[model samples]
Target: MAFGIMMLFVAILCAIAVIREVKERNFLAVGFAGISFLVFGWFSVMTIFVSGAPEM
Candidate 1:
């Protein structure tokens, strides 16, 4: 849970960066930030579905 939260924070940061890059009209930077957002966002989602807790 904690790790996922951290990854989520990073993902948020990347999303913000992507937004800023887009506003600045930086194609290369936007592409890099967009990729970063996708990777981190996927990791966060996977972490949420597959946790360390055991089933009953």
Candidate 2:
């Protein structure tokens, strides 16, 4: 539960940064922040519910 909450908080921060960059008309920053959001969200979900490793 705590991890989930932290993920949400991070996502919100990323969203805020993206919005700020968009308003400033900085395309590079916007793209970077957007990518950051995707990566952070993806890793957060993947790490939390990961499956067991396969046998060698």
Candidate 3:
């Protein structure tokens, strides 16, 4: 649960960075934003499907 929230925040930050990079025309920052978005998305999916507690 916490991880998902963290990832969501990260995704928002990355999205902002991506927009900034586009405005500044920085390829590196754009690439980083893309990677961050991918990672954030993966974590979001994991958080949704993975159980938070041990199965009983």
Candidate 4:
């Protein structure tokens, strides 16, 4: 659960980076960040679904 949360955070950061890179017209960076966002987002969601969320 903790790992999932951490990955979720990382995915959010990558998403922000993707947007910024797109605005700057850095195709390479955009590609990297976009892929990172997709991979990390998927992993995080799946992990959370499998393991369940942490207690508040």
**Which candidate achieves the best TM-score against the true structure?**
4
At residue 25, give the lDDT of candidate 1: 100
lDDT: worst 10-residue window of model 2: 47-56
Once fitted onto the true fold, the runs of candidate 3 whose alpha carbons sit more than 4 angstroms away are 52-56
Candidate 1 residue 56 Cα shift, in angstroms, is 3.6
Q: Residue-wise lDDT of candidate 2 within 1-56, one digit each (tens)? A: 45755775787788899999999999999998898888778766665555333546
TM-score ranking from best to worst?
A: 4, 1, 3, 2
Name model 4 segments beyond 4 Å from true. 53-56
Pick the winner on lDDT between candidates 2 and 4: 4
- Candidate 4 structure, TM-score to reference: 0.91
Which has the higher TM-score value, candidate number 3 or candidate number 4? 4
Q: Which stretches of candidate 1 lie over 4 Å from their true place?
A: 52-54
Cα lDDT of model 4 by residue, 1-56, tens digit: 89999999999999999999999999999999999999999999999998995657
> Could you give me the TM-score of model 3 versus the true structure?
0.75
Task: Per model, state how many residue pairs clash.
Answer: 0, 0, 0, 0
- Clash list (residue pairs), candidate 2: none
| Candidates ranked by lDDT | 4, 1, 3, 2
Give residue 33's error in model 1 in angstroms.
0.4
Give the range of the ten consecutive residues with the poorest summed lDDT in model 1.
Answer: 47-56
Give the per-residue lDDT digits (tens) of candidate 3, residues 1-56: 88787888888888898999999999998998989988897887688568465677
True-structure RMSD for candidate 3: 2.7
- Answer with 1 or 3, whichever has the higher TM-score: 1
Better candidate number, 2 or 3, judged by TM-score: 3
